[model samples]
Target chain A: MLHIVNKSPLERPSLDACLRIAGPGTVLLIEDAVYAAARGSAAAPRLAEAMQRLKVCVLLPDAEARAIADRLIDGVTTVDYAGFVDLVAGHPNCQSWL
Target chain B: MTEGIAKKFMFVNRSAPYGTVYALESLEVVLISAAFDQDVSLVFVDDGVWQLKKGQQTKGIETKNFSPTYRALEGYDVEKLYVERESLEARGLDEGDLLVDVTVLSSGELGRLMDEQDVVLSF
Candidate 1:
């Protein structure tokens, strides 16, 4: 399954909830959720652990918008909207952890 | 709703009480769900922890102080409240600083509780 989350972990717990509730799957972080991928952020350590079980990806444009594109946690893949579509197509189903 | 069987409904509050409308909106729904006699559970995480802090003075911000409403939740029979330990500690807050009683649990523990719920609402 593909799990999508779009809230900042600093201001909200959507990312944390998603990481906990979701099984092994693709986690696509968009909007403010991109902040969780930034290195040195409090949420980064948890996000890094989540990578061991899931293929974590962040929307590049979103990260760039936040200016954290350069400091993403080591293993998180950067994707554009095109990559986003392919992920949805690849997964049997998805949950928008909105 | 269903005649007699009460479904477990968890309301996951993730927003602060002020600066946005989400926190207040979430509380209003919790009240209605109680009226329907559903089993209600409230979980606070991240900035949502601020909602339960003691002695909030919203007068300076001109926003209606609503943190006290959480204290009133028990009168509505909404007793099950949980706060994420990590979120609380990260914010430099503890149970004693809160206005009401709550069980602090880890994310893993909360996830198990969420899995048992029939419905989960997030704000």
Candidate 2:
């Protein structure tokens, strides 16, 4: 399964719920949720810990748009829109953390 | 309308009811999805657990009280409802507080259940 989050961790509990509830799946951060990929942010450690159980990916354009492209944590894979579509297709199904 | 291809669908609700449109919209979507004959389950976590709290008085708020519809889900054969124990405890609510009966599971158990589903929808 693919877990997609679009809200910032600071503003909403969407990412927190996804991180806590999702199993061994791919977590693709989009929209404001790309902030979770940033190093030293409040959502970083938990996201990094989840990496042991799930794959972590960030939407490059979203991250770049927020100007946090260089601040992302290690082992976080960046994907474009095509990659996003492929990730969705590759997984049996996905849950968008709204 | 494919009669025999039922998918396991788990709808994850994590927002407070009535504060925003999410809870109501999710309920509407769930009802529509049931027509497809999918194996549907509803999971309430975080503030979403509040959606099932009994005695919702929306008369003063002027919002149509939609909590009653949850009781009607079983009629649609969408009887699978699960709530996170941690969430319930945090909110000081128990099974008796909810309008419907639901299987309460630990967050860990809930994650495993989520992994088994063919589709997960979050609201």
* Best candidate (score: TM-score): 2
Best by lDDT: 2
Candidate 2 global TM-score: 0.94
CA RMSD for every model?
A: 5.1, 1.4
lDDT of 2 by residue, A1-98 (tens): 79899999999888888887777889999999999889899999999999998999999999999999999999999999999999999998788888
- Model 2, stretches more than 4 Å misplaced? none
Q: Which stretches of candidate 1 lie over 4 Å from their true place?
A: A1-3, A8-17, A20-48, A54-98
lDDT of 1 by residue, B1-123 (tens): 769899888888877888889999999999999999999999987788998989899888998887888989999999999998888998999999999999999877876676676777776
Candidate 1 Cα lDDT to native: 0.87
List the global CA lDDT of all models.
0.87, 0.92
lDDT of 2 by residue, B9-52 (tens): 88999889989999999999899998899989999999999999
Candidate 1 lDDT for residue B44 = 88
* Error at B102, model 2, angstroms: 0.4
Q: Give the Å shift of residue A84 in candidate 2.
A: 0.9
